[model samples]
Target: MSCSSSGNEAFMPDDIKEKIHNHPCYSEGAHHHYARIHVAVAPACNIQCNYCNRKYDCSNESRPGVTSERLSPEEAAKKVLLVGGEVQRMSVLGIAGPGDALANPGKTFETFGLVRQFAPDLKLCLSTNGLELATYIDEMVEHNIDHITVTINSVDESGEIGSQIYPWIFYNNKRIYGKEAAQILLERQLEGMKKCVEKGILIKANSVLIPGINDKHLPEVSKKLKEIGVFLHNIMPILSEPEFGTRFALDGVPSATDQQQMEVQEACGMDMKLMQHCRQCRADAVGLIGEDRGAEFTKDTFAGLSFDELQIKYDLEARQAAQAKIEEFRFFLDQANERVRKEKEELSSDGHTILVAVTTAGEGMINQHFGSVREFLIYEAGDKGIRFIHHRKVEAEYCAGPDGTNPLQPILDRLKDIKLILTAKIGGCPQGDLAAAGIVADQSYAYQPIEASVLKATRKYFNLPEEMEVN
Candidate 1:
C-alpha cells in the first residue's frame, strides 16, 4: 500500500489513476470481470455495419433482432434481479439490435428507467452507431446513463453509401441517404461526444478494426477521442465467421490481427485493448452480473428468468416458480469449478494445491496498483476456482517524500498462506524478505501479459499458460 521513494511518481496515486483511466484494466477496477447485460430493446438499428449480420455472437454470422423472445422493461428488470448479485461489477442494458437505439426512445429510455429503479448501483451502458445520439443526449444524461459506446466506421463519406458501402446521415430529423450523410453524422458524432463530456458523461469509443478501409484512420480517431476526454478505446476487430467473414466485407475486411491492433493502439497513443473475452453480446444479452464478456464468462447471467428458458413463457414470477432451473445452474457451476480445478492441476497446480502464479517487477513496485486504484482485474479467471492475491505495484511516493516504511505492509499483513512468488526480477531487500516469508521466488515470462520492460525492473506479473497440462 505504501508507494514512496525513488521514481516517486510511482508512489503518486494520481498517476496510476491516469494509467487506469486510459487503460482497460482500470475499467474493471478490483474485479476480473465487468458484468454487462445487452437488452434487445429496440430490435433495430438506424445504420448498418458491413461486417455485421445483426446476430448474437455474430462475427457477421449471428442474427440480429432475434425475434422469438423479447422482454418488456418490467420483465427485463426481473432478469436483472436474478443476475445482479452474481457479479462484482454490473452494466445494465445495451441496445444492440436492428435499429438505432435512440430511434426507439420510448422503449429505450423506459427500459433503462426500469433497470435504474431495480439496480440503481449498476453501471449503466449502451452502444450505438451515433445516428440518433444528439437527439437523446438530454434523456441519456437525465437517466444518469453514461458509459456509452459509439461505433464509428469512417468520417469520410463518398457517395449515397450506395450498396454495402454507403455513408448516410440523420440530420434535421431525417435520414438523409448519401455520402454527405456520413459526413454530417461524423460531425454529429463529434458534437455528441463533446456534449456528453461537458455533461460529465463517461464515454468509451468502440472502433471496429476494419482492415483496409478505416485502419489508417485510427490515429486520427484516437486524437479526436482523446481530445474529448474519452475514457478508453476498444478497437474491436471485425469478427469473422467462416461463412460470411469475407463475403460482404470490404475487399479486405478480415479480422484485424493482434499485431495490427497493437500497432494502432501504440500509434494513437491510446490504450487500445485486444478485448480477450469480448462476446459481443446481442443488444439484449445478459452477461455475468459484473464480469467481462471478453473473458468468455457467461454463466448465470439471464435476460429472462431461468425458468422462462429462452424467454418468458409466463410472467417472471410465474416462470421463476420453477426453482429447479436455479438448482440446475448451481450444479453446472459446480461442474465448471471442478473442470477448471482439474485444468489448473495439470497446468498451474503443483500438487493437491493449485499454484496461483503471480509475476512481479524487480523494484517491488507492482503492489501499488492493488490499493483500490482500479476497477477491473488483469486476470479474468473465476474467483471460485482459485485463490490468488498480490500486492504487485508498490506505490512510490512522489514530491520527495520519505518512502516512510512500505505501505505494502498492511496488505502483506493480510495474506494468510501465500505459497510462491514468481518474478522476472526483484531487488535484494525485497527478495530476502519474500524468501524469509516462505514464498519460493522464481523467474518467468513465458506467456505473461504485463509489459515486459516493467516486469523486468518494476516486477510486472502475468500467469496465462500457453498450454493446459493434461494429466
Candidate 2:
C-alpha cells in the first residue's frame, strides 16, 4: 500500500495492528485520536552531533534535545500516572531524551519499570541514538517495549558523510573522532536495528536531512532500512536556527527548506513507509503530536502526591472505556475519509493538485482560529488524496488592530504558495490580505476533519462537484 493513502490498517498484520492501532507515532491515522508523552529522565548522551545541543529550561523550542526539566524515575512514574489520568487519550509512554535514552541506561529502565508497575496499561517505548542498543534488545523485549525509534542518518561504509554530522562519540571508555567514530556509530546502529527487528520489535528509522552532506545519501539509507524489515522511515529536516545554539547554526550551515525535505521524503518513500506527521518533538513533550502541555504537570505539581492517590486517578477501567468510544468514532471517521479519497481520485483526472494550509489545535481537525494559530499544517489535496506535506510555523499569533506593521503580511509571505486556507474563523483584514496574494481563505468547513475538509474545499475552489458525503 502507498504510504500516502489514508487508513493503512488494512495492510497491517493482526498482531501489529493491536500494537499500533492507538500509537500516534507509529500509525498516522491514530494520531488524531491518541496522544503520547515523552519523559526527560535520561539526560546523558555519548555522541556529539552538529545538529544537536541538548538544553534544559528551554520551553520555547519545540525540537528534539530540549526539555524544561529532568526528572527522576520516581517523579517520572508519578507524572505518567497523573498525565494518563488527565489526558485519557494518552496511550504511549516514551523516554525520548533531552539526551540519549540508552546512554543513561540505569535511569531509563528504572523510569520504565516504575511506569510499568504503576500504569501497566499504557504502552512503553523509547528513542535512542542506537550506540548502546545492541546491549539492551533483550532488556527492552523483557520490558514489553515493542516500538523503537533510531536516528540513522548515514549508511555509507566509508563514513565520509557521517563524519560531517557527528564529530566525536564516547564509546568503551574512549572518545573516538572523525571517520573512525562515524564508522563505529554506523556499525553499531545497523547492528542494533537488525537485532531488534529479528526479535519482532518494530523499528522506526529517523534520518536528519543535512542538505549538502546527506541529502542524496538518504535513499541508500532507506534501502538499507527496508532490507532489514524496518517498519517506517521518517526523514526530518535539519533545524539550524541561530538561537538554538547548535554547532550547525553556529557554523552558518543553512537549514533544510520544505522543498528539500519533500524531495528527500519522495526519494526515500519509494523504499518503505514514510512517517510524515512527526513534529520533531521535544524530549519532554506532552499531549498530541502538534500540541505540548508539559508545563501543566511540572515536578512541583505532583510533589507530595502518593501512589494510592495516583492509582485512584489512573482508573484503568474508565480509561479503557473511553478508548473504546474513541475507537468507535475512528471507525466512522475512516469510512467517511475513504469516500473522500475516492472523490479525490476522480477529481485528479486532470492531473492538477493544489496546496492547502490548515489551522488546527490538533485532534486531526480544523479547530484553531486564524488569529490564534501558532502554525499551519500544510497538505496537498487531489490525486493522492489529502497528504500531509509539512508544517509552516508562524512567528507570532496574529493580533488585530493597527498597532505596528501588519501581522498578516508576514503570515501571507509564509503561505505564498498555498491556494486555500482552512481555518475556524478569520477576520476581514487577513482575508483581504490573503485575497491580494491570490489565496482563498474559507471557514465553511470550520471544526471539521482536516483531510476531508481539504479535499472538499479543494473541489469547491475549482468548481468541482462534491460527489460524496464526508460526514
Candidate 3:
C-alpha cells in the first residue's frame, strides 16, 4: 500500500496493507468485484481547471466535476446507507465533487463524519484539488479517512507550464491569476502530498494530460509524486468539449488519443506504479467503474419518502444482516473447532488457549473504530491456531454518553473469555479499565483483513510455534 517515487514499495502497517486492496480504483482485484459509491455533497470549487466545465451534466457523459443533483450532508448520508444495504459488496464511500471537496469544507466534513457513524466499515475516500488539502490533512486523518486522491495537474515550480493550465485560483479571499496563482497552487499541492505521506495516509496522485500543454511534463510530475511516496499515479486524458465551455475547448486543443495515453502511462510506469483503468468518473458516480448508477438514484427517486422513513428502513435491513452474519460465524466456528480437534496438540505451543476479540463491522476486515463498534468478533487461539467462535454483543456503547461512567464494563463482562482486544484506537480510560479486568488492549490494528490479523496476532502474542492449520 506504501510506495515511493523510486518504484519501490516500503513496509507499512497491517491496516494500510488491507485498505489498498479494498478500494476499486486502487486495486485490480477490488475494481472487478468490489462496488463503490460517491456522494456529491460538495458543490463549490476553489480553483479553475482548463478542461473542467461545471455547468454541464449530460448524465450520459462520465467525467470528474459534474453532477446532476447536490445533496446536503444528511441527505448524502441517507443515500449512502440506502445504497450500501442494496449493494452488499459496497466497500468504499467517497466525496468527489461537482466542486472541490475541501473547498466546501463545512459540508464535506459533516457528511464524512455522518458516514463514519453510519457505516464504519466502509473505507472513507476523498478527492481534492490540493489547494486546501494541506490545511485539512490532520482533520482528514482524525476522521479515519485513509484513501485520498489529490488532483495535481502540474508540478512545475516555475509556474511557466502551470499558468497555462490553471488561469486563476481563488485563494485567501482573493482571485490570483497568472504565475502567482500557479505558484501558490503548485506549492500547496506538493506540500500537501508530503504531509499526506508523513502521516501514512495512502495518496493517489491524478494528473490530467493536456496534450501540447502538460503532456510532456507529466513524466516529471509523476517523478515528483513518486518521490513523496504516493501509492499510485493516475494519468488521465483531458476531455475537450465545446459544450463544457473551457479554454481547452475554445483554443481547439485536441484530447489525448488512446495511444498517447498508453505512451504516457508506460513512461510513468518505469518510475512508479501507473494506474490504467481510471474511468474519469463523475462526482456523483455510483455502482461500478464503467457502469454508473447516478441517474437511477437521483433526487426525484426520494420524492415522497422522508428521512425518518429511510432511517427505519435502514435499521430493519441492518438488523437482519447483523443477525445473519452472527449465525454464519457461529456455524463456521463450530465446524472449524471440530476439524482442529485431532491436530490441537501439534498446533499449540505451550497448551495455553486464549480468546481474542477484534472490533469489526464486516466479515473480512477490521474497518471500525473501537468507540464505534457494537459487536466484537471473537476468535479462540492456541496450538490449534485460531478458530472463530461467536460475536460478543455489547449492551453499553463506547461513546453513547458522557465518559464519566464506565460504558465498557458491560462489554468487558460479556467478553470474559477474551484475553486480548484488537481495535483501531482506544481511549485512556477504557484502556485502563480493560487492563484492570486482566485484558490486554491493542490499538495498532485497523482497516485490515480479519483472517490476516488473527494469524499474525496468534503467532506474535500467543507464542504459537507452528502456523495456524484451520479449515
- lDDT score, candidate 1, position 138: 91
lDDT of 2 at 342: 34
RMSD of each: 16.8, 2.3, 19.1
> What lDDT score belongs to each candidate, Candidate 1 first?
0.47, 0.87, 0.74
Which sections of candidate 3 miss by over 4 Å? 1-13, 303-471
| Clash number by candidate, in order | 70, 0, 3
Could you tell which candidate, 1 or 3, scores higher by lDDT?
A: 3
Q: Look at candidate 1 and tell me the lDDT of residue 396.
A: 30
Ranking by TM-score: 2, 3, 1
For 1-471, candidate 2 gives per-residue lDDT tens digits of 344423455767899888888999988878878998999999999999999999999999999999998999999999999999999999999999989999999999999998999898989999999999999998899899999999999999998999999999999999999999999999999899999999999998899999999999999998999998988889999999999899999999988987788788878867777887888999999998888999999998787899889988989888999999998888777765664543324436577988899998876778999999988988877743566666877777888424678788778767878999999999998898889889999999888777788888887887877544334
The candidate maximizing lDDT is 2
Q: Look at candidate 3 and tell me the lDDT of residue 266.
A: 56
| TM-score result, candidate 1 | 0.55
- Per-candidate TM-score against the hidden true structure: 0.55, 0.95, 0.65
True-vs-predicted CA distance for residue 116, candidate 1, Å? 1.7
